[model samples]
Target chain A: MTNIKDIAKMAGVSVTTVSRVINNQPYVSAEKKEAVKRAIEECNYRQNINAVHLNKGKTFLIGVAIPFSNHPYFGLLVEGIANAAVNNNYKLVLFQTNYEESREIEALMMLKHKQIDALIICSRICGWDIIDEYVSYGPIVLCEDARGRRVSSTFIDHYKSFSIALEYLHNKGHHKIGYCIGRKTGTNSKQRELAYRDFCMKLNQPLKPNYIFYDCFNFEDGERVVKRLISMSNPPSALLISSDQVAAGISTCCKEHNILIPNKLALMGFDNQPIAKIMNITTLEIPLVEVGRNLFLQAIENNDSSHQEISVKLIERLTV
Target chain B: MTNIKDIAKMAGVSVTTVSRVINNQPYVSAEKKEAVKRAIEECNYRQNINAVHLNKGKTFLIGVAIPFSNHPYFGLLVEGIANAAVNNNYKLVLFQTNYEESREIEALMMLKHKQIDALIICSRICGWDIIDEYVSYGPIVLCEDARGRRVSSTFIDHYKSFSIALEYLHNKGHHKIGYCIGRKTGTNSKQRELAYRDFCMKLNQPLKPNYIFYDCFNFEDGERVVKRLISMSNPPSALLISSDQVAAGISTCCKEHNILIPNKLALMGFDNQPIAKIMNITTLEIPLVEVGRNLFLQAIENNDSSHQEISVKLIERLTV
Candidate 1:
């Protein structure tokens, strides 16, 4: 119940003097400091840890701004982050923005208020203008896309990964390759879409606009995409998907329809999630734990001057 | 940027009087209230909405204390709570304690500080004495068990559910039945263990000590349990597991070993999550969304009463 005001009154000094003494800052005489310390000890005053930490410009909390926490990709990312956080003696306070502008802004405001030491955005939903504005407040790190932004970043290259999946299918004598991606709004999806477009243009392959399906990046979304693709006028022999969950959906649907994988319809996916292994869907295994570890390191260092973008590698499986 | 103190100083009034005017509380002079309001308007002071909401003794933030958020069962529970919270115009703040006593105490302290309006404990890790101390601060609703000393709870009857699963297997002519439970420290697991004991005693069947396996309610844990059971001299023909995630692990392990379900080993699990449906694991469907709704209703009512318990029902599947 004891506050700085109580310590100041007992020490016969102003609240500022008491604050200086507690923070170990300069300008307080030894006598006054001793009196303040004695008064604090007498009252057993417990200084607010978060408040004091803020005043000293060192909030121990790290803010993670993400869209959702339930999906296997994001879930694994969070698990990696959480594991590293526990090891590094740090705590995470999540901000589930659900891709809303207002909620994303709230996470940025925490930096200005000195509530969070730094921020790690897994996937940005807002435009770069807003992201640029918040970058001045504190250290801001991006997880997925760099977007050629000035802020520090750590992510896998979606363009190259998507190209590799498609190129592999094309080389296997499967020229008619379709694709499924996450929401078109995200930077990662945009990159993947660009990769898909450029690859089709170069190969002189017919680019069917309806071949691309964009929605949530989950198993159910993948399943829906597969349904749409299967019912298409000219369904491709091979499919390139954004995430493993989506691949699972397509695989499950294929099993139900008796469309055998690799033989009937080949598939390649991204994010070699556990289910991808169980279902034997060839995928690009982006090091999720490493991504989380690097993000935490960047956040704790509190430096945005240097940015790092990790590369993605393909994990071969039976689906292809 | 402006706070109550700034308005009070400009209006030549105490901060309490300014708060009284802002909150529209009685016992403030008309002239002073008018002056405070005028100063607030002149300074363009916008109250911190979150702080003002806190001042009204209703933050609309429900703290959900769970062991893990990545698991399917807990994830579904979170989804249920989040859906209910959206309906009620509330937000959920997840506090992943990993069943640590210190973390539970921190959640209780958040309630004391009026940070979170109420608490929905999906898993109990706090002692009864500590829970008793927290009940005075705000509503604390239990979701996993009903054996609270004074707290109101919405929980499935683990004992009855376990007994039914065992009895169903017994009726199918399986005398040697195995059991896989969660950590024994939890009330739900304790009840299930007691039920197992009672069923064995009543049937006058020899209880195979090696048939029981205990682990965390996770996929890997279930697989590990099955591995140990199959290695035993005589493994039970039917196994009763505590969670769907664990059953998935066991199912995966069985598939790897080419062991047929229902024919080689009958498996019955708890918490009929979506994954259970996909894997065809027979389980008791604990109505999670209903539990969330009931707990939210209990929290809003703020009734101080003894614990409440909910019932569970078995859902037959191909695994049985």
Candidate 2:
């Protein structure tokens, strides 16, 4: 509750002298500094950290923008980022954007205003132009490929990962393949869409718009996919799910419906989450924690621009 | 990068005049105010938010300390807190304590230094003595029963909830009952321990210390429990698991090992998470999000210390 002014009044010195003493600036007399120190100790005064940050031009706070905080994927990412932050002597300001552009803009504005030293966006809802406008303000790190952009990123080659999964399904004698994703927008999803189109064209099969499922993020969304699948006259024999939570959900629903996995409907999941191993669902493992760590490191690094690519591996399990 | 001094120089005014004009304080001449405004616009200066907070003696940031960011229990609680914070125009400074006392001390220190306006500890590692030391710094809200303490809290009556579950199992004709917990130290866990001890005494059963499980948090921990159960000469017929993730793990392991549920072993889980519902495990529904919302509200409320007790419900399903 004690401010510098209180300390100044108590020490019988000007407020500027108290400020100089607190900041260790070389203007205050030794006697005046000792008096200010005694006054501070007597009152148990704790210097406001904001004032310290104002003098240093660094807040020691990083802004992390994620759509949802409770999702398994983002949870892992945040855990890694938080761990790295702790080691670097920084704290995180979480911006749960919920995939809203306005909320994402709020995070960007915080960077522009110098509230946070840097920002790491796990997934962005804003377009490239909007994100580019804030690049000169501070470091903006992305979890997607921004190799040619002004910002830095730690990304996964979603196109290659999707192609590998589709090819594996194709080799397993499954030409009728479909996929589910969190949303149809975003760079990652668009890359996966391109891979699926190329796979269909290479196999001389017409693309089925109905085969792609959108808005699948959690286990509950799996129920919606199942309902749509059963109602279709020609459902894909195998499906690639973007999240293990969703894949696990579909697997559970299949069991309840007496639909045998890998025989009735093959499933391949992404993220290789713990549920995937427990449910025995084959998945492409993306090391989200490692990606999150790299994102944080890049955010703090004073480099021009950097890009790091993380590779995914396929884990063989019973569901495929 | 243009500071107040630069603006003052450009406006041909003193720094105090520039500060007064920027803060909208009265007594500045109309011509001088217009000159300061034009200078500010010309430079496109952004007022540092930290300076604004320093002047107001308030930061629109609340601190949240959780043991882990990736756990389901804390995840749900954080989601609730985050939603409430977004609605109230506040951001969260996350301190992933990982149950370390030093980490918790850092969070308390932030409060003392006036970095965060208030702190909401979802779970605590420090003792009451240490927490009491920071009570006068700001509003410190807990997620445990802190009725007689100086801080406000929104907590569950762990003793009553544990008793209800034990009574339900007793009525179902179970004698040998064991329980699992994340740890044995916290107030909540101690209450559960008391309830278990009293249950055994009331039923004329011997207290089996070996029956109590410790360090069980995630789904993978179920494998360890099952391994220990199979190795025991006389294992418990029914078990009370504190987390649904662990319960689901035990169920999955049980199916693999050909153990029948409710026949060989009956299980009751807490926190009725999504995994509990998906796996059809009987659980106690603790509205964690609602509890989190209340905790946030209490953290922001400038009232005397208040305590809110959230009740739990029994959700009957197949696993029990």
Candidate 3:
């Protein structure tokens, strides 16, 4: 806890002399340097890392802004980021934003304040303008497409992936298809919505707003979806769930409700999470961990703004 | 990035004078302060947070060392910690130690280096002596029993909880009970093992080493357990799965293999996670988030070393 002043006082030297000695500057005399070293040893003063970071202009800390730390989606992403960070000797400063814009801004502000070397936003809640404003401060890596933007990102083509899922369902003779998503506002969700709209247009099918389930993030949400499905006058024959957790939930609920999957209610899930495999639910595999690793790598390694797109694949399982 | 020396040079003043001005010390003249302000504005030099942290001797950053970030158990614990951290205006520096001693030491080293204000070991891999060595650096809160130790902790009475589970199973006519665990080395796991041993002794049941499952951390591990169970000459009638995720997996696999629950094998899971509810798997509710919140509170709020033991409750459902 000894400050520079304390070290200087203990060593019988000026504060500036102590600073010079600590920094190993040439101006500090040998006798004064030795005195400062002795004082430091006697006081057991461990040099604060913040001061070292201030001098070096690098904290080796990458800020990761996530919505929720406990969710499976973010958990996988963080695992990828954390592993890459450890490999590079960089620690992660987690900002669990809980989808709050203010919390996301706090992460950006940390970048501007030089508390962290860079930031990788796992799930962004802020507007482009707000994010764009802080680009000059430090590297801001995103998990969504940031192409034609100042910042860098490692993103998935949500539109393409959604289309793939839709086309697969369509080929399986499922014309009345509905989908579930975490939220409608996110860029990925918007892209998926667009894909759904396009699919509807191509098939000349009416887009039933009621059929699209929102805020379906966890396993519990699946019960809500199934309850709604059972009550609907004309429920979709097949459903595309954005998260595998939700899909697994629906699968479990279907068994309880005697709703045979792929016959009465076909279920296709995204992310291909472990639950999907356990429940034998068909899903689109989004390499979230790989995307996370790329995001972290871009945050620390990239000097110029860059965008990397990761692809998703469909894993055929029992449900579909 | 314009440093203090650059700002001083721009203001036509010495580095010490600029430092005094930046620190708002009374020694700097008003004219010099005005000059420094103008230089700061012209150069657009943002005040580095590291410098402020250096002066205040506080980072407002707590280190959270967990084995993995993607696992449900740790995920839920981190969620609790993160929420508490946000409430306290603190950020978490995640150290995904992956159960490696070297990785854990890195987190301890960060505490020693004053990079983080405090550290919370969610699942400790390092020995007590190593952790004890860094106690003087800052508060190191643990998620296991650390009573009679220097550090603070919010722990569960694993032995009592495990006994309660065993008693519940025994009363339900499940004398031949086996348990699946993440590992046998952790303190909590050791306590659970002791309880299991004691239960066998009380029942005059022969100890079956092969009945105990180790490294059963995830859902996929359940398949491994089931495969072994099917091949066994006399598989246990009931299984105590430490994680609900693994329990859920066993439930799913059991159904696939035509093994009836309760009649064939009763499953008792720990940590009543969402998966447990979906699968109707009976489990011991650990209240992990509450434990996590208490852990975080202990890390920041407690001045003296403290120990808080959280209790678990049995939530009965179908799988039991």
Candidate 4:
């Protein structure tokens, strides 16, 4: 088989010119391109390194394993990831696992097979011990703040975020507060719950079991949680919600019942999403997009294992 | 260099077994797999066909070009496409273009370079003429209904959808209807405009310039649009919103002004997004996920050139 140099020689062009033509670069003249094509045919040349493949040792592809995309948290995170990816001339491969363990493993397998240069687990289902094994193949970054020295991660300190929200509510003279949670055992949810419990304990406020709502992420969950609160003989004066969407849901139900927010049932939500701004709902603003961008950047740039903690702020508005 | 056959012969295993070991298939015995790796190392073999790469002539990767993933429409479409891609053992490369033409062309370039097997343009920035050139490289599918036979497309007929929406509004005794639009020059927005104009003309109702709200897509846009309508001396009795997101925005603004939905101002929205369902806003349900699934299936399964049109339905709820 003839090599590219032999073809270049036969075509009366430089090796770089032949290489440019093969890579589909635009500078070569049509006449020179024709000559190169003819030489390639005459010599029966086959370049094993095709333009189809990305540059050697750099696939320039990133895999993101998120439980779902339509949700507010993941969507905001992806928005940041996608922008950073396009700027860096990379593409995002999303694995919508619906929080299933097997679905999450598919992205890990892709990393093992070198299908993607790195993996970003947005909402991890499995522990770091299992994920640390794939670090040898490529960078494996977790979105949650994990205590893994061998792995890289970017996360909002959910504990501090919850504390900010809880402190804000307590400052407003709301001694009794109920909070909504997404998952019963999710790392972020657990952190938020711990913060709530600790805050109540320090204040000498009763931490009632009925005040804690679990598995609350969406609008309906928030609505149902609020309705359950409303039916209680002694409902908490204020509510710390998990997400803006759920808060919005609570607001909707309140409207139907003629229950004025803050006065009747004060509410503070998480993830200061656009709707939070629109609805004027006070929330602990977790910069999810920034977390995603930083996670991807760290995976690509920081080969040395490191962890990044994104800070959160409390934005005051009408609902709270 | 030694090949798989030589390694197989040295290990006393069939070439199939050697290939299976290289590909990381599960059924191979641990002893046999170890022997093949040893034989491969001894011969100093370098196969062009590596496990890192997909099978020869097939990357099993599809590129999807969308303006943004954070939006409800694109998010739903991606969910469908991602599900299909995972089921087919393929991966999705998202090109979040933010509707930029240059960004869209990047996905096309990936197709040209054989990085992805096909390209799915969810919302096109460029026309078919430019995209037709890349059809020879691989399949290019459009998310919107296009007048291109060479390329396969799966889309909700915007014209038909608007017609259905308009007729329903008209039947409900809405003579003067205001409509919101995302882009003044977008294909879907334009199609919707034409439908509104045609419907009014056929019904002997005049199409008012003030009734058409341009550059509205998100919740904030809808709020601003409705505020503009309220200040007008002659506001339309009903509004046909471009998206459920915009409708949700409109709903938020309405609540702020103490305005009643359906009773004071009748409204219609497009894309029955989760928010829309939660808000109980009347909307035309565009099967965005189904469109995504059919688009991927068509690109992968269809060899012969054809077009598919996904239908939309109006889901009657509160605030129609």
Which has the better DockQ: candidate 3, or candidate 4? 3
Rank order (by TM-score, best first): 2, 3, 1, 4
lDDT tens digits, residue span B121-211, model 4: 9888865545665778888888766655678888777888888888888789888788888888767777888888899899888778988
Worst 10 residues of 4 chain A by lDDT: A46-55
lDDT of each: 0.75, 0.89, 0.87, 0.80
Maximum-DockQ candidate: 3
Chain B alone, TM-score, model 1: 0.81
Q: Choose the strongest candidate by lDDT.
A: 2
Clashes of each: 0, 0, 0, 0
Instruction: Write the residue-wise lDDT of candidate 3 on A1-320 in tens digits.
Output: 34555677899997656655664657777888899999999997756665667677888899999998888888889999998997887889999988866578668878988889999998888788577778999999989887998899999999999999999999999989999999889898999999999999998988889989999998889899999998999999999999999998888888999998788989999997877877788999999889889999999875779999998989999998
For every prediction, compared with the true complex, DockQ reads 0.11, 0.31, 0.32, 0.29
Provide the TM-score for each candidate, comma-separated.
0.81, 0.85, 0.83, 0.79
List model 2 lDDT by residue over A93-135, tens digit each: 9998889665677688789888899999999888885787688
- Runs of candidate 2 with Cα error greater than 4 angstroms are A1-48, B1-48
Candidate 3, superposed: residue stretches over 4 Å from native: A1-52, B1-48
Tens digits of per-residue lDDT for model 2, B1-320: 45566788899997656766765768889999999999999998756665667677877889999998889999999999999987776889999887977677768878988889999998998887578778999999999999999999999999999999999998899888999999889999999999999999998889999999999999989999999999999999999999999999899999989989979999999999998887789999999999989999999999979999999999999976
Q: After superposition, how far is residue B298 of candidate 1 from its true place, in Å?
A: 4.7
Model 2 reaches what TM-score against the true structure? 0.85
- For model 4 chain B, give the 10-residue run with minimal summed lDDT: B46-55
A127-177: candidate 1 lDDT, tens digit per residue: 775676667778888887674676777777778888887888888899888
